[model samples]
Each structure stands twice: as structure tokens, then as C-alpha cells.
Target: MTKTITAVGFNFDEKQSEMIEKKLQRVSYAEEHIIDLIVRVKHEKEYSFDIVANFRWGVQANVKAEDFDFGAALNKVMDVLDQKIKKEKEKVQQH
Candidate 1:
């Protein structure tokens, strides 16, 4: 799948980018079914994470979360994303 990560209001370093990639491995089983995965992180008073997963069959799922710590927010968002992906996969299989 094609993956895109964008960060606003902060200098997103290589380490952080790598961390995201590593975290995304949680959903690697559904990679072939995913068309694109977009992640946007905004930092104001706190960190906000917005993730969109576009499936090959034209389905889309979005998950969002916010936290004072970057890692915490990322973890929260990714956990939600993992669940969404699993649900979508089940739907596709049933059809």
C-alpha cells in the first residue's frame, strides 16, 4: 500500500517517521487490500493524529485521537486504526 505521513507545526524527524512506520506493522496483514494510508499529525497545545485508510475496493476508514504526548497519541490512534482495519477485513471476506 502507498503510505503518506505529514506533520504540521513541528519538525518531524527521521526517528519519528521510522517509529510510525514500525507502528504501522500492526496492520501489515491487510497491506495488500489497502490502496493508501494517510497520516496527518498536528501539534498545537497537544498532539493530534488523523489517519485515513483507503481500501482497494473503494472503502475508507478514518481514526482520530489527541494527547499531550506524541507517542501516547500515536499509540491511541494506531490502536483504533488496527481495530478498524480488522473490521473492514471481515466485511470484505463476508462478501
Candidate 2:
């Protein structure tokens, strides 16, 4: 799967990037079914994350989460993303 991570309003260091990569690994099982996985992070008064999962079968799932803490926001977003992906996978399997 093609993965892209973009950060706005701040620079992400290697450690932060690595942390994101590790978090993303949780969804690696769906790599073949997913076409593109895009994650956008923005920081202002709080940390916000937007994740989009484009499936190979023309389904798209978008999830968003925000928190005052970076790790919390990331975890929240990923958890939702995981659920969305699982739901989509089930749909694909049923068809």
C-alpha cells in the first residue's frame, strides 16, 4: 500500500515519524486491500489528525480525531481507522 504522512504548522522529527510509522503498523494487515493510506496532522491550539483509507475496491474511509496530547490524538484516530477498515473488509468479503 502507498502511505503518506503530512504535518502542518510544525516539523516532525525522526522520532515522531518513527512513532507514526509504528502506529501505522497496526493496520498493515490490510495493506493489500488498501490503495492509499493518507494521514494529515495539524497542530494549533490542539493536535488534530485526518486519516483517509482508499481501498482497492473503490471504497474510501475517512476518520478524524483531535486532542491536546499528540499521542492521544494519534491513538484515537488510529483506533477509529482500524474499525473503519475492518467494517470495509467485511463488506468486501460479503460481496
Tens digits of per-residue lDDT for model 2 on 1-95? 99999999998889879889999999999999999999999999999999999999998999999999889999999999999999999998998
Per-residue CA lDDT of candidate 1, range 6-94, in tens?
99989788888888989998888989999999999999999999999999999999999999988899999999999999899899899
What is the C-alpha local distance difference test score of each model? 0.93, 0.95
Alpha carbon lDDT at 38, candidate 2: 92
Candidate 1 RMSD to the real structure: 0.9
lDDT of 2: 0.95
RMSD of 2: 0.6
lDDT of prediction 1: 0.93
